[model samples]
Target: MKKIKVMHIIGRLPVGGAENLLLTIVRNTDRNRFNLIVCCLDKEGQIAEKIRQGGIKLVCLGTTRVRHSYRKIRRLVELLRHEQIDIVHTHLYKADFWGRLVSLLYGVPVICKTEHGDVNSFKNKPFYFKAAEYLCFNKILDRLSDGIIFISEAQKKEFEGKRIKMKNSFLIHNGLDTKRFSSSNKRRSQDRSEKLSKNNIVIGVVARLSDRQKGQSCLLLAMRKIIERYPEAGLLVIGSGEDEGRLRDLSAQLGLDGSVSFLGVRDDIPELLAGMDILVQPSVSEPLGVSILEAMYSGLPVVATNVGGIPEIVRHGETGFLVPPKEPDALADSIIKLIDDPAMAREMGEKGRETVMSGFTGDIYTKTLEDLYVSLLKRKCRNRNYRYADLFEIT
Candidate 1:
């Protein structure tokens, strides 16, 4: 059987949950059965280099302006025709819109979009912007796409609550590179121990520094309260974004400058995660926290907000604690509990590691995705007029 050519389209390869997951999928995919290509609608971001280094064919259109959707569609048409892509898989908002539109127009055999974040996240925006997404993006996606993949059940429910009645939808959780983390855990444990004093307990928050969505400000408040009791406790703030300056100012204002260290856009995430005793994700809204998984794989207990797909991952008192979103006091109380009982924290961390290694590893995630792709392709082949095998034929 000839390999199915799959072209994944995304806005850019930034170091975020979606980008990381995409890279994982590509890395773990069965190359004998599938040919994977990546197309970036915007300029290549940080994660692009890793994808290229893997010897994958990557195309960057460099469509910088948001208003250049027409240009994107045109370029996509040319690329699809040139490459004879069998499947057009899209991620992120801009890619979903332009990729699907061009794929549909180009008569691509199968087109699928993965919803990385909750679409209803735009509900709080102005009426005009919300209306545009409702009519143009969501409605079109629901009607035209071959299948929609939701990373978490909570994300699927949120879309359903908004009355998105797509024909085929799937819930496939995001996965971690467990083998990498597991090995790194053993090697770094001693290093981490050597770096921290006997009295110090380090807490980590690894996510984009966007305060509005990530709620890092709330974590800062919680850290302030945490330090009042455990003065030696330190918070490691990882990842950078638009709100870094404001968050840094807030850290100083709350007298947490000494306790909070902002380490932005790290390549040594596994090493960083191993150093920490506990991980906290204080997002006002989250669609499956990947950092939490990374921490879990590194054998660290987690404390995250109980919003959007988080509860699905965190079993609240089992693997980690789930505090309500935007409540600094609740965040503090949970961290304090873990801090007070080191034994329980270690137990939880072990359980969390077990949880990820068993079900949420990159291998498991890739297998599920490959199965879905093949199943969808087979089904489409039977019913649809387009024949993928014919695309490879010479006239």
Candidate 2:
């Protein structure tokens, strides 16, 4: 059988959720059945190196500073033609715009774009932010993207609210390498145990410390409240961005001088997650929180903002608790509730881990994506469309 030649175009391969999700797909995809190539519209960051390390082909345009560069488009078009790409799968806005335009021009069989939870794009962000090269081009651009995938149903519904309809839309939840998380937890258990005292509690958050959206300030304020009750508690701020200095200032202003630790971007996330007692996501808007799932895989109870697709995952009183965004009081209260009741927190963490294992593993994510790709190619071929269902029959 001839392998499906897939070319994934993206803004960059930074250590972000969308990049990580794309890497998850790249690493987990059945290589024998799918020949993969990556094209980054901007400079290749850390994850791009990891993709190349996997022995896959990759290219970085590095034309971010060159505004309206036709050379970048020409290069992409040439690569698509040279590779005979069957599908062009794109992630992020810049890539979506160029990928769709170039794929249409090159007569690629299909164009698929992953919608990585921009619930705040239209409604929450400032008008200027929305105006700056935004792709809410709605139905017009949707026509070119043969398949539009929403990482969460909340994101799809947000788009639907705008009456934007497109062909070949689907919902595919992101997944984690639960086995890797499980093994890492076992190995790091003894090490993390040494840091834990009988009265100590560690609250953690793994998110980019951006100026907007992530709501780290809210978590810091909540930590001040947590300290009043559990004085031994400390907050672990993982990842990094432009807001680090401002967040650090806020930490000092709140008299949480030593209570919060900003570790910045670290490669050993699985090991770090092991050291956490409870995970909190205070994002004012999140299509879905990948860190929540990662924490769940590591057996940590989650406390997240109730907005977006989070309600679908947290399940209120079941796996974890959800609070309204920006309310430091409510956020602190939820965290305090977990801290006060150790047995309940453990039970919730156990339940959360079970949910991840049952539904959101790498195997399930890979198969669903592979099936989607096969179906898209089959639909085009059924012009004698091939049936992805048939592939399942023989395998």
29 Cα displacement, candidate 1 (Å): 0.4
Q: Using Cα atoms with residue i matched to residue i, what is each candidate's TM-score against the true structure?
A: 0.93, 0.91
Per-residue accuracy of model 1 over 24-140 as CA lDDT, tens digit each = 988888888889999998889888999987789999999946577678778889999998888889998778777887898888988998998776666654465477686766677
Q: Candidate 1: misplaced stretches above 4 Å?
A: 64-67, 123-131, 187-197, 389-395
* Residue 254 accuracy (lDDT) in model 1: 95
Candidate 2 local lDDT, residue 215: 94
- Find the number of clashing residue pairs for candidate 2: 3
212-288 per-residue lDDT for model 2 (tens digits): 78899999999888999889999999999889999999999999988889998887888888888889999988888
Per-residue lDDT value at 217 in model 1: 97
Number of the top TM-score candidate: 1
